[model samples]
Target: MEAFWAAAVGIVWGLPLVILLAGAGVWFMLLSRAAPLRHAGHALAILSGRYERRDAPGEISHFRALSAALSGTIGMGNIAGVAIAIAMGGSGAVFWMWVAGALGMATKFFTCTLSCLYRKPDSQGVMQGGPMYYIEVGLGPRFRPLAMLFAACAMVGCLGVFQSNQLAGLMQAQWSVPAPLTGLLAMTAVGYVVLGGSVRVGRFAGLVVPLMCLLYLGGGLLVIADHAERVPAVLRAIVLGAFDVDAGIGGAAGLTVKEILVTGVRRAVFSNEAGLGTEALAHGAAQTDEPVREGLVAMLGPFIDTHLVCTMTALVILTSGVSPQAAGVVTTAQAFEASLPGLGAGLVSAIFAAFALTTMITYAYYSVKCAKYLFGERRGGAFVWIYLVLIPIAALWTPTTTVNIIDTAYALMVIPNMTATLLLAPRVLVAMRDYFARQEG
Candidate 1:
């Protein structure tokens, strides 16, 4: 199963798919004139609870929605994923990560705008929205297959096994906590929140996201400051590495520039999920009818997660005096251990637990919604119990295997998602223009 999944990742995530994903981002950024970037301040205001409507049609506040989305994107990917990128593609991979983050903002803007533009109520009469609703409703019922495909892919893609595997790996390595024990705890915690659905997940994320991000950032800054002098050289490696044709490191030597680009973009996509359409699922539940508003808000996910959190993790790993090894979460824990000595492992473990738990629950929200789309709320309800069972099972898998499954599932989702977004780009353009005009007026 692991080898099959790995093979599937290579075949599906080839150069053409990388170009399609990154190129779509570039195209959306250019087409929108970087509108999301320019309106970021406004987006911040909206996120700050300034634009909320109590009687709005959606289920959660903008803050909770964004938090929920951020939790999923900002988890294991920001740490383990970034470390993996550096270990494989060299420090230069961080450069492509920035490119991916920038382009992702535009992708988030367009896809999420369509999310709100065509949202409809589910059987529960909740105003649910996502790639599925927008793809079918906005593109017409004839595109139902594409919508179905997105939902079906989402069920597997959002399982978040990588998060479990990496976090469980760190715990097992550092504290000798058994993976099964860690998985049981995770299943209980996640199931408690997830059983309550998106509202509960959103609330959990809203609280945990801010605190965990701060904790992780605070710890990261201390390590970076301790090795402050090495910062310049590490940054240099990241920049120059971005353009080198043979930029790989360790066992990944002889890699081409294309390989580096693919690695960076792929990791960044996994980290912040710019064009993966999962961003839309969270934002679609925000308590507002304005499509452009949510798009603008969703644009912040890549920026905060990829640019800020992932960059911090990258710098920490590079500057911590730890060897640039490919041990995923264990390597990260070592980096923290290098600086803080007696306190490193414990601190990093806490941070990872916070990050990974929030992500697992948020992803539960995404998967459950997709299940509802594919199987309806009744039978879909069964997916939660099934999802809970998978947490412990996933914790037993190797990180490579878990990552491969996620990559393949996400690859499947991107096709239907990007196709729908690209086909409906003109409508989003119109909405963007109108929304801005009203704001200025």
Candidate 2:
């Protein structure tokens, strides 16, 4: 099974897909005139409620929507995923992750904008939006097939299997709990929150995501500060490793350029989900009339997830001088333990639980959205039960198998999503022009 997954992920995440993901991001960045970079301040303003509308067409506030999206993207991917990249691809992989995050900012802007622009009313008359809605409504019924394809893949892709599996592993490692027991506990916790649907998901996310990020970031900072003297050397190793030609190079524990780039981009996508169209489902529910405002707000996700959180995780691991080959969460725990001794590991375990739980809830919302798109509103509730059931099953799978399954599904979802986003680029560009012009005027 492991070998099969390795082969599947290898084929799915090959060079063409890498080029497509990265190239499309660069294209979107250029096409938007670097809107993500130039108008980042505007994005922050919108997130802070500057352009809020009490009667917008959507369900949740921009902050809540972003919180929901962040809850999904900013979890295990920032912690365990980064550790995996560093372990497999070496320290240089961190550099490429930064690159992916930079490009992902623009990618999210275009995709999330389109999600809002093309939202539709579900059978229940509730506003619904996502890659499926945008692909169908924005591109017309001619592309309904592609919309279905995306929705189908998303049902499987957004299951939080990776998060569940890893969280179970964390429990087993940290507290010596049996995986089955941990899985049951996790499922009950997740099922309780998610049964209430998106409104509850958004509210829960809005409350917990920021607090979790702060707690994790605060802990990470202490680790970095304790090893302040090694910071510059770690940074140097990352940069040098990213471009190092030798296959057995000295830095980051020996990773070539190709390995670095591949691992970095893969983990970055897993972390921020820039092109996978998962987050757009969350952002599509934002209570706003301005698609551009939501898009701008959405762009901050990659920055916060990868740039802030993942970077901290990388630094802690690198500075702690932990083995590059160490297990994902264990290496991170070691770094924290090195810094604060007894308290550090416990804090990380708590943060891990929070991160994993929030991710599961938000991902349930994404799966519910996909299920509704695929099988109508009434059938959507059925998917929640299915999702809860899968949590324990996912806990039984090996980490590598779980990662491979999710990565393959993510790669599949990205194809239709990126195709639709590229085709609809001109519309987003026009919207951006008009929106910015109005703001300037």
Candidate 3:
């Protein structure tokens, strides 16, 4: 039964990511007249809120929504995901990650803008939006089933297995705490917030995200500062490896140039989730009438996740003189350990705990939005219960099991959302063009 479910998830989660992210990124960059790239300065300026004030529409501010979504993406991926990519793929993976981040900017802008425009109050009368919203409203009633499928998968993916894996991994590496214990504690803490609903989740994220980001970044900076001499060589290796045609790390089977490019891109997509449409739910709740302003703010997510936070993790791991190939988590821990000695692993463990908890609270908000939309309030609690219970089950599992389950769930959610995004691409373009035209005038 486990294997059956695993395979089902793999098929659903795996295929959509390729077509949706890689394909759509390529498509939007072309169609937007290279807007994400050409108007990079504009995107950054808008992110700074130079054009719009904080007194915009929905519920929370743009800063809060980005923080909430960043809390989700910036968690394990910046740590473990980078570890795996560097270990299996090579340092070259970091370069491809940067490429993915650059292209992801436009993707995020389109999906987030559509999220607000199509949003409506759910059966429970809460403001709701996401891939599901676009799938149902933009694609119309003909696609409602697909929308439900996407929502269900996201609840399981983000709130359950993903957070479980993150907490479990961090605990095992940091304090040698058993995964089951960590998972149980994680489950308990998450249950408290999820029951409180979206407003509570938003409030929680607004507080947790900033503190966690600073703590993690500060630790990473300490490590990087100690390894200052190796910085130039590490940067050079990353750039050279990005284009090297030969398999340098693992010989013929290790990591080829092609594999590095593809996997890095894949991991980057996983890390920031810009085009996936999940973060749209959090941003959609923003109290803003100007959809484009929200979109502009949303563009900043990848920069924070991939550009800032992920960069720190990548550099620390690369420059620590540890081999990610031999020991994934331990290698990363050692990098920190080299700088802080005994406290390195423990520090990272705490960061992971914070990251996992924040991710759970934020994603729960995303899932509840979809739940209220699909089943209304009556069945919503049932869905939450199922997710809350799965947290410990996920943590208790091995890393491989946890990651596979997460991958499967991710694919399932992305398929419907990506398809809807494609179908609604014209609307996004029209909105962007119309809004920008006015801004320019």
Candidate 4:
């Protein structure tokens, strides 16, 4: 199983997929005229209720949709995923991660706008939208096979296994709790929210995401402040390592510049989910008539997840003198412990608990949406039970196996999603021009 998973990840995440994802992001960035960066403040304004519409044709508010999406993206990836990138690819990997995050903003803007623009009503008449809906509606029924392909891959990709696996590992390491018990507790917590549907998920996300982010960011800031003198040196190492061909240390001697780029881009996509199309399921539910506004709001996700949160984790790991051989959540815990003494591991455990739990809940929503799309809304509840059961099973898997499974599934999802997004790019550009013109007028 391990060998199979390793081979699957290697093939799916190879150079061709990497180039497709990155090249699409660059194309979107250039086509949009860098609107994600240029109008970031405006995005925040939309998030803050500036253009809110109570009578809009959707289920949840913009803030709640963004929160639900962030809940999925901001969890273990920010904590353990960054550590994995640095562990496997060296500190220079963080530089490429930053590059991915920057271009990802544009990807989010275009994909999310299309999600909102082409929403369709499900069997029960709930407004449904995502990459699948947009592909069928915007690109025509001839492309529905591609849409089904995305939904099929998403059912497996957004399973929350990595989050559950890492959270279970943290519990055993920090408190010696058994993995089964942690998995059961996690499954129960996530099932409670996801069963209540998107409204419950949105409200829970809006309330929890800000608090968890503040707590984690506050802890990360303290660590950085305590080691203020080492910041410059760490930053230099990251930038230089990004381009260094023979800069590997110890067992990392095989880490070429290509490996660094692949690892960084791969981790960044996993962290922020820019091209994965999962977040569109959440953002597609936003209660607004303006698709462009939702796109602008959605673009902030990569900035927050990868640029701000992941960078903090990288700094903590790099400056703590931990060996690059240390991987995943354990390395992050060591960094926190070194910087904060007795409080580090415990605080991180708490933050990880919050992060992982929220992620599971949101991911369940994504899976249910995929199931509903494929099997109809009546069968959606069945998928929820299936998703809940998988959490415990996932907890039993090793971290390496869990990561490989998710990376392979996510890479498969990106293929159809990026292809559809590229084909429909002109529609998004037209919407952007009209939306901005109306705002100015």
C-alpha root-mean-square deviation, candidate 4: 3.4
Candidate 1 ranges beyond 4 A from true positions: 1-6, 87-90, 160-162, 232-237, 240-262, 321-331, 396-407
Tens-place lDDT per residue, model 2, 55-96, is 889889888999999987776546777877777777788889
TM, every model: 0.89, 0.89, 0.86, 0.89
Superposed Cα RMSD, model 2? 3.3
Tens-place lDDT per residue, model 4, 2-90, is 99999999988677776777788899999988976799999999999989988898888888998899888886657767876777888
How displaced is residue 349 in candidate 3, in Å?
0.8
Candidate 3 on 205-315: residue-level lDDT in tens?
A: 878887888888899889889879988887887787788834223211355677778778878887888766678888888767777777777877887788778778888
Candidate 2, position 175, lDDT: 85
lDDT of each: 0.84, 0.84, 0.74, 0.84
- The whole-model C-alpha lDDT of candidate 2 against the native structure comes to 0.84
- In model 4, the clashing pairs are none
Q: Please state the error at residue 81 of candidate 3 in Å.
A: 2.3
